[model samples]
Target: MTTSPSLLAAQDLHVAFPGRHGAASARAVDGVELDIGAGEIVALVGESGCGKTTLARALLGLVPPTRGRVVFRGEPLTYSSRALKAYRRRVQLILQDPTGSLNPRHTVYDAVAEGLRIHGYGGDERAAVAEALSRAGLRPPERFLLRYPHELSGGQRQRVVIAGALVLEPELLVADEPVASLDASVRGEILALLLRLRADLGLSALVVTHDLGLAWNIADRVAVMYLGRIVETGAVEQVLTAPRHPYTQALLSVLPEAPGDPVVLTGEPPDPSRIPSGCRFHARCQILAGGEAERVGVADACRSEDPEVLGGGGEAQVACHWARAGITA
Candidate 1:
């Protein structure tokens, strides 16, 4: 909630993919500014193709930003192989699909020890792996050491994946859809495990998910992304319980068992390469569609002005013409 980034941050970040065959470049992450405080969990929520995953990859230094920069511990992230190699040890990635993340041939012990071996960890490998597995909720860690990926259940495999990251003893975990592949029950278990890990290890996390309910339950703050930018961000309760942006409101409106009829905005988000001139969301905005912006005398601004979100921590903020006009649909 502070004004500065205490851990990892993306400042004016932009990652673009040059199109081929005379096509325009696709700006996957156009201009993102986000921060994660030490030991705090922040959820990046958006629909598919919203650049959430691209942003995560940039934060991990896997993909270098074309325009902006990533910062860690108040220092700008360096992309050199030597710097990245060292950086990866302190920041680990937890992939979405546990089944594909693990090597079927690798034993649990081998999978967990791979990082230690890669980093040339001189300490006791067995003890470290055991401790990591134990911390990841695999009790009596020795019991699963020799088991193969095929031998373990879905939940257990995910725990192994989490153990792989924990083995490195990272300060931050960037998890991309950590529970999306599991069943409802397993999802709850995984969420609970993440919370437990945070409490036990003082670890910070950046969780990329489309589920606002998951964010509401697990994250201290929620950042709502659309297209390639964050449109709203603040404390989870403040944003989820009372979303200010039209996009965030539409996202929450479609949740299961949520009150009122869903706000069905027609058409998908604009292409990243051909982002509109005005508000990128104006084409599909419910407020604009319902004439609320016109009645409030901000329709022109909604159609011509692209307001930047208020970021870099502190109080809740939103980037929308109607909201800025002190109006809500």
Candidate 2:
């Protein structure tokens, strides 16, 4: 199969915040690279404070990266007039908390139609609103049009937010922890809705989530991040079932397993600001200093020199010195 053109690309992206106590800034996203093709879903998976949200904001131009480039549809993105307007139309973000994202003052219809109004789609507002609402599974759109966000259930409110994004007819959707705030029962439904939208609309998605289960369930490809850097990335099945990076393996080990399976992680991940030297995971990685060291070939070099992202089988890629040293899932 031929590879589609990337609708969005982020190269060597870095985002930093002013450091406390007058020190240098804390780098939240460090030397990150990502590509979302015309109609592919790439999930950014990691533990909390791994810079997933920071990366998402960078993609939307909501937060500027300290360094690197963000290109959309072959053009460099900027916050200026024409480019900003065009970028806004092509890329939209769906926040985690629907209640907070949606304005309590506006009704559902107004919220969904707001984008159209701002973008000057005056004549087709009604039709567009109805279609967007319908596409988000809010069928019989009239029934919910006049209702407010508080009037809807948690699932319904989230769907309304989806509808608002859909109404813009964006080419790329960056959903940052979209289902994290929903009830467990409703989470599945929202996930199904997003997948369905992808299938029907051929929309590209960048899903930022801490839940590996969610990534496995909906992502076409998975990129695992740790301490602001990508450690592993590959097809969902390959990365989840046979992760190469120690961090990825550790993540999988802790996942709730079937009967008789053991947990993976030995300790908590290190703080981002005070990241470990060389490989950020050297401190917590079992392969680097555990019973598997002989078999895995994790040497002192792995701890002294950071490994570059290397090509793996298929479209997979990993950044670990011992990737080919007999490490397994």
Candidate 3:
């Protein structure tokens, strides 16, 4: 929670996709509101199919929101091609897989220089590529310039992908599972690189990941998403140490602890097309299932009325009927 105004924000954002047999479009994302301020790192944490990645895409305008708007620097995003391109140049996306993101045929120099070409850089492209590669930790940039994707190691390949994004000198990065495919040792390197980039360049980032540990490692704030909507948001220490929402508590319980039984959740997350009414997580919530919700007199509301994000804002916000009643397990 930086006191500075938000650099990027989602205002009641929603994203839906067409369903089978011309059925009603399934809402993959439903009314997600988030904010990332200058020089701040925000992690969007959740399970698979939780719409964290889609929300990242929507923020970058790679996928248009079905409703609401994305605001950058306090202005609504424009839909025009030119405006969108400019916006994209300011906000870059870092994909999950380094192997899939890099082109096997293109040399590292050409790959890093691609963005410069697309945006019609008038200066020396080679110098820009070299600087980008250097900044991305590929020291002695010339050593990597001639190498193809196949010639590089996995860590090197990811660096190249990051270098590609860095070449544009973007203000904000929407990184979706940026280190998921790397080796355990290499994961730390990438995370450190991201932190360094943020510190050195004043870059803000929205990282989408399932690893709560990663969120704790780098993010200033963490937003926990379940079935598209954010159920809890707070400073990393606050959310991870004292989670208010049932879903957040359950998620944290699974993290490898010293001596506690992990909260094993039953059943898979609900399908997007058949999303549950009211609180989407009610069906899988252990607290609600164990009669605690009834004791708190929120059982009815948990099953019928949608719980909105509440918690007096700033560094701690939760969207749960039971949580509003101070009933977090």
Candidate 4:
């Protein structure tokens, strides 16, 4: 979508965990297809337990998919320790909690330099760490070099974690709710920092988030996940501002800035281990439950047929019986 080379992609991916006593496996990531273009930012958004984080793990090769493959720069991941080790150098992760990610005993320099050491970087470690720190917005990197995680504020700790990832010169970053732990003021700063990093470093990213508002602020494109599958995807403006899927519409409607009163969804998402028959979302779909799909003559289909999996292309796509039929009522 950014007219850049495709950097990272997942094709028909699935990651499932076996249940106790041979129960149905928990399909944490099921039949997902997504792509992040070079220098492009794509947000993977969904509520907790919908498998967004699991998908990120699979993409980073932290969790091997039960099926399908992850393609980086056009090559499928081999999952061999040697290949994965090399692959990690080009793709890094930034976790949600900086305090948890950084060792309290280790100074900022050691923390940021850890990746370089692990990767066996041959260049000047100090210079690389300094540049990474500076790039993460910690000015005068020397000032923070010796400071431990306990000495820094929440925002500074986050920058240090970012610096750690940057030290590897990674081409892609899989950031899971990178700003969810920051204060309101600091949140904007971190988001801006990510944007700046993208512009300056030509970095690509698959940002995992539950906040649609954050996606609107920082992403070039969006993939909305539900029940371990992508229900909708497109350019950010198209997907976030004008969502087409009923699940996506419900997600967006609950945002504080949305014009209408929030559409309160009924019941928790069905367990991943036993996903519903037909449309996985049909039992709780507001549109179908509200009689719109029935009026449009697709409610029966919604209850008996699974929608097609999204192809992860640039074109806006929604996996909905009524939507695909152009019969929104």
lDDT tens digits, residue span 128-240, model 1: 99999999999999999999999998999999999999999999999999999998889999999999999988899999999998998899989999989899998898898
Please give the clash total of every predicted structure, in order. Answer: 0, 1, 0, 0
In model 2, what lDDT does residue 174 have? 94
Report clash pairs, candidate 2: 253-264
Candidate 3 C-alpha lDDT tens digits along 171-266? 999899999999999999999999999999999999999999999999999999999899999899988988898888888888877136777788
Off by over 4 Å in 4: none
What value does the lDDT take at residue 245 in candidate 4? 89
> TM-score rank, highest first?
4, 1, 3, 2
- Selected candidate, larger lDDT, 1 vs 3: 1
lDDT of each: 0.91, 0.83, 0.90, 0.92
For candidate 4, what is the lDDT?
0.92
By summed lDDT, which 10 consecutive residues of candidate 3 come out lowest? 308-317
Q: Candidate 3 has what TM-score?
A: 0.97
lDDT of 4 by residue, 266-307 (tens): 999999999888899998899998889998889988999999
TM-score of each prediction: 0.98, 0.93, 0.97, 0.98
Q: Is candidate 3 or candidate 4 better by TM-score?
A: 4
Clashing residue pairs, backbone N/CA/C < 3 A, model 1: none
TM-score of 1: 0.98
